[model samples]
Target: MLGRVLGGISTSLFFATFECWMVAEHRRCGFGEELLRYMFGLMFSVQYLAAIGAGLVAQAAASVVPLTRLSASSSWHYGGYTAPFDISLACLLLAIPAIQMSWTENYGNNKAGAAGTGIAASLRAGARAMGSSWQVPILGLAVATFEGSMYCFVFNWTPALDAGGGLPPPHGLIFSSFMMACMCGSSFFGMLDSSYRPVKVLLPVILTAAAALGLTALSLARGSTSNGAVFAGFLIFEACVGAYFPCVGTVKSEVVPEEARAGVYNVYRVPLNAFVIFLLLTDISPATQFGACCCLLSVAAGAVWLLGRVEQTR
Candidate 1:
């Protein structure tokens, strides 16, 4: 109990410190638009690195330290063994809010003098408009659904394809390679000018096609299909899904006002968490079925694209 309490407090403090640092960074840079974008990218990269490092450390520790020894020393049962790690991860995720709060406060307080009342009023008005709009909520749900589905498919599909479809390890390697393709896609998308509207780029149609391909791959797996065909389909699907990220980021930025963007992004996380819980509760066959359901959801997301395009036209 004491260790858990201490861990939580320590994690919160670390997050608070990181947030303060991010805020200071924003202020020191004078919140220049280009600077903010680069900062966000850098922070994202750093966070990913931190996550990787933490995972490696946890894996190493698990390998060397017997669970029995740790359990005995920590007075934990098998059921409660994962709690410490969970608490640590919770602390790590809290850094996101800390950083957001810091940046928000910096903009709200420091930049107020320069923009004066008009800028503040505009921000307030945007917030109010956002609060009253169903569009933001709907867009958020679409984004969350897409994100959750992609994660579920990736996590569940690889093993299913290996076991059920008789695909070898090479297929899994192909999936990783497809992820690398996505990294390239992200870099390509990032290079495009901010003036380029992602919706106009036909991201919805591309995502819909990807979902179709994913479903096709699953169907092939179910039908005892050839490994080559299934692998090729998976690769194509993963590549397209990888390309979807930049468009999603751009859409989120365009739809949500800057002041409200963080809050809106946070709200999207709720559905993602719910989806993860749903995945956890599902059996293997059910998880595969859920992936198929996600493919259908992607078709629905394409409809969201039409709605978004209409809004853009307006």
Candidate 2:
């Protein structure tokens, strides 16, 4: 249904092809998961470069056109085909040769015919994998809890700030700064040892996360705190979050079974989605919600330590 709405039959076909290729890539990259995960972090950092460019374009567009008028319309191209769309088309065209020239390696040389089990069997296998390792779901939930809190802020920060002492309305500048921090964090964490043992690295990252969330709770608690202080706390939190992606990705790669990686990851999102929904449905203040996030991060740090112990024992 969504595919039909997006680009009719063409989008559906594109997605079908995309997923098939992606699963192949996933299998090839499964063994060196940490390195693959680190590469993804670097890729994300590159994506943020695109984001910065987009923001600049948007800002420039705003300067020439009144935001009020721009916001009133859904179409940015009343003048017919837009330059952005043209550039997108050209990029897609160029990517064909780029992809062909890209590095290709697969650690596992299993026959392509043995790529997957039957759907029913695969589903059953995935279910079994969920219970096969406590480390998988436990670490997954812990990471999700921490990330879900960050996403809550991403979606609600503007209103959350507005509610607390009439802090200034949200602007693009704050979001751009947060993305910059995230990029830096990803780059920094990517340089860490790409070992399967993530406990040593994750321990400090999670602890820092807890401390940052604690500060956020504190900043929000004091209604009299200057908005600058609150904003700074948020920035610090974002900076810590930079390392979170590669760290958690490494942990997930360490524990998640190769056959069930996709299914297990989807299961991991259940708790995260539920957590965010609960927060959004309630009328709780940002401080209260942030305090809750702090507790979750604290629990996650402990769980991560225990997970490390389990890994070492094995």
Query: Using Cα atoms with residue i matched to residue i, what is each candidate's TM-score against the true structure?
Result: 0.57, 0.73
Q: Model 2: per-residue lDDT, tens digit, 1-314?
A: 78435653443334233333444476565545445666656765776666656545444444453323234655444222243344555766986888678835321234463456444654465578879988876787676788777767776666556655654543546567777877887777777665535567777877886787678678778764466666776777776787776666656655766556545655565577688788878988888788887887888788788888888889
lDDT values for all models = 0.53, 0.65
For candidate 1, lDDT tens digit of each residue in 82-159? 543655667669967886776544443345443553435544554564576666766666666666666666666566
Q: After aligning candidate 2 to the native by TM-score, how far in Å is the CA of 197 from where it should be?
A: 4.0
How many steric overlaps does candidate 1 have?
A: 0
Off by over 4 Å in 1: 1-131, 164-178, 193-195, 205-209, 225-227, 279-300
Model 1: C-alpha RMSD to truth? 7.7
| TM value for model 1 | 0.57
